[model samples]
Target: MSPHAELVSRLRAAWLSGKTRPMEYRLAQLEALGRFLDEKKQDILEATAADMRKPPFEVEVSELSICRSELNHTLNNLGAWMKDKHVEKNWATQLDSAFIRKDPYGVVLIIGPWNYPINLLLVPLIGAIAAGNCVVMKPSEITRNVERLVAETLPRYLDEDCFAVVTAGVEETTRLLENKFDYIFFTGSPSVGRIVMTAAAKHLTPVTLELGGKNPCYVSDSCNVQNVARRVAWGRFFNAGQTCVAPDYVLCSVEMQEKLLPALREAITEFYSPNPRESPDFGRIVGDRQFQRVQALLHSGHTAIGGQTDAGERYIAPTVLVEVQQDDPVMQEEIFGPILPILTVASVDDAIAFINARERPLVLYVFSSRKEVVKRVLERTSSGGFCANDTIMHMTIPSLPFGGIGQSGLGRYHGRSSFETFSHQRSALLRGAGRETLNTPRYPPYAPHRLPLLRAATETKRRATCLLL
Candidate 1:
């Protein structure tokens, strides 16, 4: 058998046993996962740091804490989330019990990304486990240290029968996708997302793709320059600009761009110090190839600030580029590095036009103290999410859904959205044996008199609701 075939078969058998269906079973498993996090905290920090020089604070906030929040939130709410949601009924089903049952999609595959490996892998896993599905989680092989750590450690805490973590590189991952899954949740680039989707199409399997695109940050002239610079710098430079939701590039008027350049430099210095390479808080690109790709993008426009690169360490200092054009290399793709390109627009309309001209981003950012400008940008452009005066802080809210639209990605997951994504909503209605008399309106006897009763029985219109036949 193929590498994945046997594993899929094993998980499928476990799922068929119906052991994962009970609320108690799910809670127990989730609690075990929480224990894993608490026990493995130091190891995770070390692994991420070894893999990409991910700062300890960054790992704590983005990796460890986000996951714990997801875990605790799931633990606190799983009972309620699993309960059948009773929905309102039409006249035809008024006497019946009608509800939407959230059910697991049998065996599922969760493919994680390199950036924020722990959070991305486990957050979705939390939902899948809560929804009671046997899951096979594949963390990105790019972050080798973390991948190895997860492969070695994660399965010990959870029931080995219900959940398993697999480590695979590009070829192995492609082979793994050949096997069928009830649902596939992929977090990666758009190109790989297409491949996963195409593979899923053979089985007509459902998929949720969390993809990345060129997220544009539009800075209005009315905004505070320092605030905008600091916020954008934080979002873009976090994870060394490897974040999917990070601001890809900036759009502002020439005047604002000029005013913002010095401020951005000051923000970078404040956050990472004058010598970012020496700063412990700064991170390196995940891999040498990624470093080279990001390094090449620096030439897209004149370097306005720090553009230092150290190939040996795979480190690129927090850099800013001004006089960038729409057709520049930096604007051509998602800049997943510590390089920020500023392109000037004539006005907010021009900025909106520039944004609309390209594919929809994962998120659209507009920094303006004025409500009208913020509202105008929110109304005109299309993106997965929006932040008025901030950056990635919007994603910190568990209540909000984090996903994309169009080229950015498909479907959403976070908090309740995560649970909903992994679950299949099964609509059901129960009728009592005594209710047969109420079904007399249909009876398959085609007649003019029956039409009125049938309409009355099924009426759902606000002004014309009828509860009797």
Candidate 2:
């Protein structure tokens, strides 16, 4: 039998046996999982590097550190998060006490993307475990090294009956999704997200899709040009710009574009040196298919600086293209590689209009010194998140919910948001036996005389509680 099938059977048996009922047991499992990752840090980093040619430090910083932080934060806050929160009770329901109870959904499926495999997978896993739900983690098969490690190491460190790793390509995922799940959490492209949602519709499973769109970075005239370039350069080429939240394209005035491109080129040279492919810090496109796709994008533009390639090595240099039009193929889809296309606009309003015409993005970055302009952009454009005078740093804030809107994706999850997403907020109301004054009028008889009393009672606040003398 397949590994996924075996895992499903085992988890189903455990679920039927009621072994996953207690919150204490689930919390214990979460604590153990965190420790497992802590102990296997080196192994995890090495595996991720082998699969994606990522530098060890990059793997540690971008993937491992974030995962550890998320796990630790969830562990620290789980007790408080699980406690029923008290809410203000209305006069209409004044006789009752109101609070929200967090309940676990039965089984969940987390479909992680290839980029930042460990971060996307482990962070969501933290939520599912914290919320006391059994999980089926389908790590991207494209990250072969990390997938192998997760499939092998997880069972050793975690409760096999509570969490399982299902490793396969499309066919395995298809068969697995055929089974009913309480929730589905997916992070990848919108194209694939549509398919996931359509499949999920079969079972009416709630879905959390963290999908990607072309996240645009706008460079305004009032901004510090050099700082904007440095930030954009880092975001554009990080993870070879395979990041879903990476700045896909740039919009600026003619003067800003001219000044910005050179600054960006300088930043790239400083960050990765002239020969980026040979630099240990730089990354490559994941495979030949990605390399070809990026190469095709380069062919569509007037290359301003550094349009070079090494197909055999899967290397595409940090490139900058200028004078790109709205109709260019590079503009047609997401350029998920180390390529930056500068689209010039006359004014910020024009830039806003251009962005508004397309699908809402995952993030909109505004590099402007003027607070009013930044505020206007934020008000006008609807992205999952925004950053001013910077790019991608908004994702670092654990307080902010990180996800997308419209074509970018649906639902948000991070820290408290993740806990809420994984858990169902069931509400309850309890009343005392003696406080029956409000209930008497609300029951059976709909009298004209009782209407004024009900209205007056609801409009006013309750007085202080007093004990009988």
Candidate 3:
């Protein structure tokens, strides 16, 4: 038997004991998680830096801080979130209690990606725990140090019986996925998402695939060039552009593209020094393989701004490519690196058509001074999320749901959405035991006299008040 089989059995036994059901128990585990983040601050920073040279500030904000925010938000709202939500009743069971029981799926599996390893892994763990499920967390082997840290340290803080950290490579992970899980949450590429989904189909287990895609950013000529450039640059280059929601390519008119080129150069220079390789603020690509993949994409178009590379260091300077062909290799896949490409469109209609023709992105960005332009694009396109006048900031808000449509991804989770994604809303109703007359409508013996009584008691009004919720 595989090593994880024993581990799965242990968690399943714990979950079956009903130990994870109490609100107090869930709170304690979540609080212990917050302590893990607080105590492991330095460890997390060092681990990510060792793995990818992620800048300290970037780790703190994008990785550590984001996870902390999720933990605290879940802690604050878990009480209300776990309570039985009373739903409106129809005429049939007016006296009966109707509610949605916020029940937890038994034991779940969460697979994290190498990029933003801590954030991606822990964010879903927080939700699974908040929803009162026992979880097995799998950190990516690609980020060795982060994986080691999580495997070694996280279990120390939380209850061992309810949670576990599984460290596995590609083959072991394939073997590991064969076991049954109540639910599975995966974060990575769409190709792997398909594999995970296929594995889940064997057990008929429900899954939330938080996959990545080539997100697009549209720049209208009406916007301020400098502001638009800075926001787009930040979104594209943050974490060295390993971001799943980073603006993959820029779509604008020739005039706007010309204006954006100089402004983007200025923004890149200001964010990272002119010599980005030496700058502490900038980060290196995670691995030699990833470095090679990103370096090859530079061949897509002539480098417009920066294209310097040091293979030994796995460092690629913040790069912007222009005159890029629609069929180029860089445009063919998500540029999960410090590379940005610009492609000119004749008009908004053309831009929308171009985007619509391809797979829907994780998030679609539009920068325009005209509200109608933003509104028009918003109305026309579809993505997991949308941001007007900015890029990636929409995801920082916990109130908003984050996921993709069609090929991009399959589920949404952030704050409340996270809780909802992990939770199973079980419909519940309690009727008085003595309601024999009321129970008769749902039972056998059909008669004319009972028809009017059944209709009055059970049949709902055709057009009642429209519930805004």
TM-scores, in order shown?
0.97, 0.93, 0.97
| lDDT per residue (tens digit) for residues 292-340 in model 2 | 9989999766999889999988889989998788899999998889889
List candidate 3 stretches off by more than 4 Å: 464-469
What is the lDDT of every predicted structure here?
A: 0.92, 0.86, 0.92
Candidate 1 worst ten-residue window by lDDT: 457-466
Cα miss at 383, model 2 (Å)? 0.5
Clash tally for model 2: 0
Q: What are the RMSDs of all candidates, in order?
A: 3.0, 4.6, 2.0
TM-score of 1: 0.97
| Model 3: pairs clashing at backbone N, Cα or C within 3 Å | none
Residue 150 displacement (Å), model 2: 0.4
lDDT agreement of model 3 with the native: 0.92
Q: Candidate 2 — which residues are off by over 4 angstroms? A: 1-6, 9-23, 432-448, 451-469
lDDT of 3 at 150: 94
lDDT of 3 by residue, 85-177 (tens): 998787878888999998999999999999999999999999999998999999999999999999999999999999999989999999899
lDDT over C-alpha atoms for residue 101 of model 2: 88
